[model samples]
Structures are given as C-alpha cells and as structure tokens.
Target: MPLKLYKKRYEDIIHSDLIDRKKNLKLIQLMMDMESAFSIPMIKNEAWNERNKDVIQFFQQVSNSRRL
Candidate 1:
C-alpha cells in the first residue's frame, strides 16, 4: 500500500474503538516496530546489495574456493 494510505490506516487504528484498549495499544506498538524494522537504513542496505550483486558473488566465489 502507498505510504499515505498506510499512515491513514494507522491513524484509523489509533482512533478506532472496535478492539480493547490494551490490544489496540499492542497493535500500535507492533506497527511502530514494523515501521522501524523496515526503515531507511534497511532499505538502503538491500538496494546497495542488489546493485552490487556481481561484487558479492565474486567475494563468495573467492571464499568458497579458499574453503576447499
């Protein structure tokens, strides 16, 4: 989902009274954790690794050869 929509959903969850307050608080905390876990540094690392796949493969091959 788009970030804006996702944020809106989060806001809705924060305000909605459908669930017990404790569960709602837990859900919010989990969502916050999820957001942090997938934040900028993690994404940048993934993108960097993707862009450097050939370099990574080269290092892996060298390491495997040394292990033989």
Candidate 2:
C-alpha cells in the first residue's frame, strides 16, 4: 500500500476504541522494534531502507505521543 494510505489507516487504528490502548501501544512498540531489527547494516537494502526508516520514526513519534 501507499505510504499515505498506510498512514491514514494507522491513524484510524490509533483513534479507534475497538482495541485496548495498552495492547495497541505494545503492538506499535513491537513494530518499531521489528523495524529496528531490519535496519541492521549487515543486511540492509538501499531501495526500501529509507521507507523503513520513515516507518520506524513515525512509530516512535506515535509511541511517545501515546505515552504522554
């Protein structure tokens, strides 16, 4: 999916009341951790690395905001 659409869906999930906040936060944290793991230099690919970086940064911001 396109980044813009993915972001929209992410925001929807964030705002939705269907899931427990703690669970959602944990999921986000897991996503960020997974992204971080993929970023290791030994296996990183240039083509999609920037996109992964963007996703990791986005998740970090979301996680921080949710904590506050």
Candidate 3:
C-alpha cells in the first residue's frame, strides 16, 4: 500500500507501527536510496526566491563555519 493509503491517524501509527522501529528505519533508508537514484537535480535558477535564498544561505553558512 502507498504511504498515502494508510488511513490511520499519525498518532495511531506512532503507537502501533512504532513497535517495529527497525522496520520503520529500513523504510526510511529505502526511500533515501530510491530518491538519490531517481531524482533530478534542481538547477535552482531562481536564486532570488526568498525561501530558496534562506535555504541556500543557511547551508553555505553551515559549511563555511564548519571549515573553521
């Protein structure tokens, strides 16, 4: 079933499926692998978009500070 197909509330899953924490971890890993293999790189040509600017700057500042 698609993740969207789950009809349970978020709390329901937290209380029930969370019992299988290892399985949830594996699902998350699988999603990451699939996304990296299939996703296209966004050129992000709209550098002036305010939210994008914030995100880009945040990462840039993080990297620069980490190097120090």
Candidate 4:
C-alpha cells in the first residue's frame, strides 16, 4: 500500500486510544518516517552494471597478466 494509506491508518490507530498516544506518538512517527525514508529507490541499476563491468575487466586483466 502507498504511504498515504498507511499514514491514514496509523492516524486512526493512534486516535483510537488503543495505545498510549503521548508516549508512543514519537515512536509511531519515527516508524512512519523510517518507512518513508526506506521506501525510496536507493539502488541504481546503471551504477550496478558499471561496477560489475569494472570488476570483470579487473579480473580479466589479472588473469591475462598471470598467463603472460
């Protein structure tokens, strides 16, 4: 589900009095913020491919030098 939906659900839960809002408010907000932070795309496929290519070239160069 999208973050908005989760945020709404969290708001409802917080206001439902099922938990201590004053004490757990910070914790709940932190959890939501963390979820938002982590949901972003942190990895780039292009960067991964470039790194792999460099590694493969390094290995090939090492093997070629060993053979010579």
Candidate 5:
C-alpha cells in the first residue's frame, strides 16, 4: 500500500512540468533513499534486533534528557 502510494507520487513527479530536471532528479533520489531506509530487511536488522539495544538505549537517554 505504501509502495503503491510512493509509486503514484513518483509517477506524478515524473510527469509534472512545474519542477526542473535537476530538482526532479534530486527529489527522485530522495524518494529512493527513503524507500531503502524503510525496506523490510533494513528495518528488521537495524531496528528490531537485539544487537541495536545499545543504540536504542542511547536514543532513549537523549530523549529523557530533553524532557527534563
């Protein structure tokens, strides 16, 4: 569903005349980067695994510090 939405938005950008070629290319790259970041394998390995516990704890500490 999300991929469908992304594809639709990508097609719209490709067809739009409002943005210049260079900027359009940059936007497309950004979208691809976002897609890669949210891919299932990356999420499962980097986010859901116990190997990243320290990383998660560090972020939690930073968040808690900001709340104080």
Candidate 6:
C-alpha cells in the first residue's frame, strides 16, 4: 500500500533530520529486496535497530514531491 500525507506537515520533515545516511539507504535497499524478491524477513526483527532521521526526511521529501 502507498503512504498517506496531509498538508504543510513540516513535523514530517523535522522527523527526518540528517542522520544515518548509509544505514537508511540500506533500509531502502532491503525494502526493495523484500518487494521485488520477497525473501526479506519481517519489518521488525531481532537486531533491527534501524533508526535514522535522514531516512525519515528523505522519505518525507519523496512523499511530499508526490503530493505536489
């Protein structure tokens, strides 16, 4: 399913501050693999400490662009 967004929600942007550039990219790759390959495990795993503000921000930016 696609994501949903509201208007002028900069809180979405702020949640996505500059952090975890590389690991976030990795997360994206993992998601893609799960979508395309379907071999990925659950979103929450045993060692899933994936937290990054930049990843959040980048996703918000992409979603915001789509909204526009």
Q: Report the alpha-carbon TM-score of model 6 versus the true structure.
A: 0.28
Write candidate 5's Cα lDDT for 9-59 as tens digits. 555654567546554564556445544654423334654536545444433
What CA root-mean-square deviation does each model show from the true structure? Answer: 16.4, 5.7, 10.4, 19.8, 13.3, 13.3
| Tens-digit per-residue lDDT, 1-68, candidate 3 | 32332223222433555445544554444444433543313444453334445444433332332211
What is each predicted model's overall lDDT from 0 to 1? 0.46, 0.57, 0.38, 0.44, 0.46, 0.39
**How would the candidate models be sorted by TM-score, starting from the highest?**
2, 5, 1, 3, 4, 6
Q: List residue ranges in candidate 5 displaced over 4 A.
A: 21-26, 29-33, 36-68
| Candidate 6: residue 38 lDDT (0-100) | 29
Alpha carbon deviation, residue 4, candidate 3 (Å): 21
> What's the ranking of the predictions by lDDT, best on top?
2, 1, 5, 4, 6, 3
Instruction: Give per-residue CA lDDT, model 4, range 1-68, as digits (tens).
Output: 54455446545644554545442554345454534554422354555446555433432332332211
Model 4 pairs whose backbones collide: none
Worst 10 residues of 1 by lDDT: 59-68
Candidate 6 lDDT over residue span 7-63, tens digit each = 123334335553556435544543454344422234534332244333344444543
Enumerate clash totals for all models, in the order shown: 0, 0, 0, 0, 0, 1
* Model number with the top TM-score: 2
Instruction: Flag clash pairs in model 6.
Output: 16-57
Per-candidate TM equals: 0.32, 0.40, 0.31, 0.31, 0.36, 0.28
Q: Comparing candidate 1 with candidate 5, which one achieves the higher lDDT? A: 1
Clashing pairs in 2: none
Between candidates 2 and 5, the one scoring higher on lDDT is 2
Worst 10 residues of 4 by lDDT: 59-68
Tens-digit lDDT track of model 2 for 1-68: 44464466566766767557664675565555545555534354665656577764664555564543
Q: Report the error of model 6 at residue 61, Å.
A: 20
